[model samples]
Target: VSFGSELSNRAPTFDMDLSDFMDGDKPISYEKAKEYFSQDPSQKWAAYVAGTVLVLMTELGVQFTDSMSILVSSSVPEGKGVSSSASVEVATMSAIAAVYGLNIAPRDLAILCQKVENHIVGAPCGVMDQMTSACGEANKLLAMVCQPAEVKELVSIPTHIRFWGLDSGIRHSVGGTDYGSVRVGTYMGRKLIKCAASDLISQSFPSTPTQSCDASEEYEKYGVDLLKSEASLQYLCNLPPHRSALPY
Candidate 1:
């Protein structure tokens, strides 16, 4: 698919044009967006860039399978710490699964969504957001203990619930410097943790320490939380100047 935008001198204007993939070649150009509309300029530009691929992917699946649920209640709400990006991703994956008539269990769908973030959007995110969004059972907290990738159980928290955020009225360019830095920080933390785990196990033996904790236990006990904290701090340190970033 190819998308382009033309800015008008007097009014807000943008347009999208698309085409099909040839049998043996790539169909889309992964270039960045440069055009702008006057009134809703900045966010519009971001939305155009972000939502173009989102919409294209959503519609293609819906069209192929004639399923309206592919696009059902699917939108990324901005300025909220509630992970609109993950929501959009799960929506896309859910749509694709539905359209293709795939038998996808909830937990498996969550994993698939994580893969999309890791591979498609090039985000080094944890399974938490996508997992919860896709496989969330109402009135419960999903205990996603990270190592062998299993949803252990859900704890109930019954109360009148509310969600809110203090959005600083600041908009961020997600694919810009900050996003890349966060990704790099996350990668670094992951590498460090993996190395630490290996060293720890090697120390247990005369030649090398054998793993006492099962991989699952190590993942749940030390791996996930350690990496998350380290990555968040590293990301904060790496954020760009003049950019106000927040964490969830």
Candidate 2:
């Protein structure tokens, strides 16, 4: 029930091949997909799972009755940790909600979308990506409150700061090895913080309807503990920088 553009980048020489899953055992390399119709096994597996979930949700009337649905366009790239996958998922959820004439709150909708991508799709993404994409205001950077779907205006970008994107000659698959592990690490970091400074997340993210047990001042009172909780952040940050996963 989802609609989108062709998966492959079109060229005069040949039509790019597209895979329909993520097969961890024997992933279909990009080279193979580009050269032959045989799909990227890993991506094919993911797509199959995503497609199945979307169908079931749509059937259950989530899209038809939710106000959070709104139509939007996005060009987030996949893999490399740039959050394009979450972007598309949220965008599609927004679209379906729009089609159904639902009126759900934006923040709530963002949380739901994140859950679908992480839990339902079998990925271990953080709430930040989906929340940022959903709450993003054009020309501004969202300083994400990782837990409880809270975000604050970090700063606004120059209106004239035109962003240019460069695609690397190589593209990595979202379901490629280690990608999920990175996401899982980030999630664990948030949970670690949540276990102690629960209030920090609650006050910042009231729209989520969850209360934190610790306040920001209380969290700062135990600054060393906060630092220790975030120690695992390095793993998430150490991923190779690539075009597809850039924050911009």
Top candidate, metric lDDT: 2
* Backbone N/Cα/C clashes per model: 4, 22
lDDT (10s digit) by residue, model 1, range 1-248 = 11122221112333433323112233232212222222353334333223333333433432331313222232354434566667766666666566567667776766666554543343445667777787777778888764445788888876877545566756553445676777666655654555455545454434753424323335445654563443233322222232223221
For model 1, what is the C-alpha lDDT against the true structure? 0.47
Q: Report the lDDT tens digits of candidate 2 across residue range 1-120.
A: 222334544211212112221234333332332223224433332332243234334333342222221222445554445777667766666665566666656677676665555434
Q: In order, what lDDT does every prediction score?
A: 0.47, 0.49
Which pairs clash inside model 1? Answer: 201-209, 202-209, 204-209, 205-209
Backbone clashes in candidate 1 total 4
